[model samples]
Target: MPALEITDLTRLYRRKGGEDFEALAGVDLTVPEGEVHGLLGPNGAGKTTLCKIISTVLLPTSGTVRVLGHDVVTDTHAVKLALGVVFGGEKGLYERLTARQNLDFWAGAYGLSRRRRRARVGELLERVGLDGRADERAGSFSRGMKQRLHLARGLVSDPGVLILDEPTVGMDPVAARDFRALVHELRDGGTTILLTTHDMAEAAALSDRVSLIDRGRLELTESPGTIGDLVSAYERVDARGVPDHVRDRIAALDGVVSVREDQGSLVRVETEQPDATLAVLRTLVDSGVRDVARSRPDLEEVYLHLVGRRGMGVDR
Candidate 1:
């Protein structure tokens, strides 16, 4: 059975201007058990809306959602019980409470017994590396520490499925690395994970398969390595002092869709085929565009191609 399933999910809301806007438009997906699936999209792509719907924070206007065979609308409590959620951004932690106290409070709210609560709190605090700082007040901790505390809260339930939305959104590079390692460890221990992230490297590194969504529609779902192989990407070609005429000539070549001039007369071209694209660079050398080099496709390029390039700067 799938860990989570969504069939034709659609949500609409009335804007203040008296217009109805669709937040999630017939969104559909199925994440297999124990696999790490990624939800990726630009701004207003309904990634968060879908998360909210599944998390029971928001209701869907239509369609069916089943998390571990429990409907989000009908068996809300059962749905919550089956999953652990780590939403990106600041959590609703009590600022004045120590990490230990906060965990104890949430564990009690989650109905963990006094004995289990204490033991689980200790286990998670250590898992997130906050055991040493468990006694310190939450407000005094850094943003990364706070995120770790929230992660502990999410796992205190010992859920079967984990939903991570931008799980490492605000941490330093080191902290983000640690958190990702922890995610892998959990998945190895048999927890199915569905992750939403804007970071390309994180998605590429951790996800078994990535579902790229845009404007509430799934663009394509593919393995990260396969996504790398099948997309037309803007490859940064090295050329300095290349005149507009030369740039235009390269753009006109087959498999070269567009050419852009960046700083210091460096030209970047969107290539349909990476191999054919690089071949065009040899032509550039023949035509006098200097120093053509290839760069790996970044998440920005992939996002721009999947999501519309116009006015899509803030979906996070």
Candidate 2:
């Protein structure tokens, strides 16, 4: 069985205006064991709603979700026992309590034995690099430190699956890198993870596969690189004072597929081969376009093309 399975899941909310809003519309997804699957979407795309449903924090209006072969609704206890969730923002950690105290309180909530709780708390603190500041109050910790603590608290029960929603939000470069490494360690240790983040680069770097959600539905599911799989590669060329005739000529090149003018004196070029870069530059330069620069498309570009151009809600 898949570590996480969701089929035709839908959640609806009634507005004060007496209209129904669909938060999730017939979404289906599966995450295999020991894999990192990324969910990417704009706000209100239903990523967090799905995660909440799987974690048993919200009831689905319709459809089914199962974790580790247990139904999330009917077998809520079993599913809860198997999941570790870290949602974005502060989730009511006692600000005045030391990190150790907060962790101890959560560990006790999980019903850990006194002896095991002590060892587990100590191990988690060290794992998240908080052992050095174990006695410090949570309110005094940095954003990155609190994020690490949140992750540790999720793992306190040693659950089989981890769900992280925007886990690296507000983290510094160094902290984000370290946290990504920790995620890899957990996956290597056979922990299945369902991750959602607005960080396109992070999603591309860590996820073996990714699902693009849009307007409460699954739009595409494939390897992260293949999300914009329409072309093998692409380039963005920005030129100043270039004539329309010259742009047309460049678009008619052998490897070029489509050329679209973008805002602020930019043109995007989709190509069939990476070697098309020099050819494109030569064409543009020969056409009296001196101010031209070319670069390959990254995940951000692809994501923009997918969700942005489609008119989805862009939070960033």
lDDT of each: 0.83, 0.84
Q: Write the per-residue lDDT of candidate 1 for residues 1-316, one digit (tens) a residue.
A: 8988999999998778877888878888998888899888766788888888998999999998999889999999999888788788877699899999999998897789999999999999999999999999999998888888888888999989888888787787888889889989988988888889887668878999999988778888899887766553445565676777777777777777567777856777777666657677787887776676777556656667656575436533
Off by over 4 Å in 2: 90-92, 225-232, 254-278, 296-300, 304-308, 312-316
User: What RMSD, rounded to one decimal, does every model reach?
Assistant: 2.5, 2.8
Give the C-alpha lDDT of model 1. Answer: 0.83
Each model's TM-score? 0.90, 0.88
- The model with the greatest TM-score is 1
| Distance from true location, Cα of 311 in model 2, Å | 2.6
Candidate 2, residues 1-316: lDDT per residue as tens digits? 9999999999998788877888899999988989899998777778898999999999999999999999999999899889998998765578899999999998998889889999999999998889999999999988888888998999999989999999998788888888999999998999999999877668778898989887888988889788544434556666676788887887888777568777867776666566676787888888878888676665455555565555434432
**In candidate 2, where is summed lDDT lowest over 10 consecutive residues?**
307-316
lDDT for predicted candidate 2 compared with the true structure:
0.84
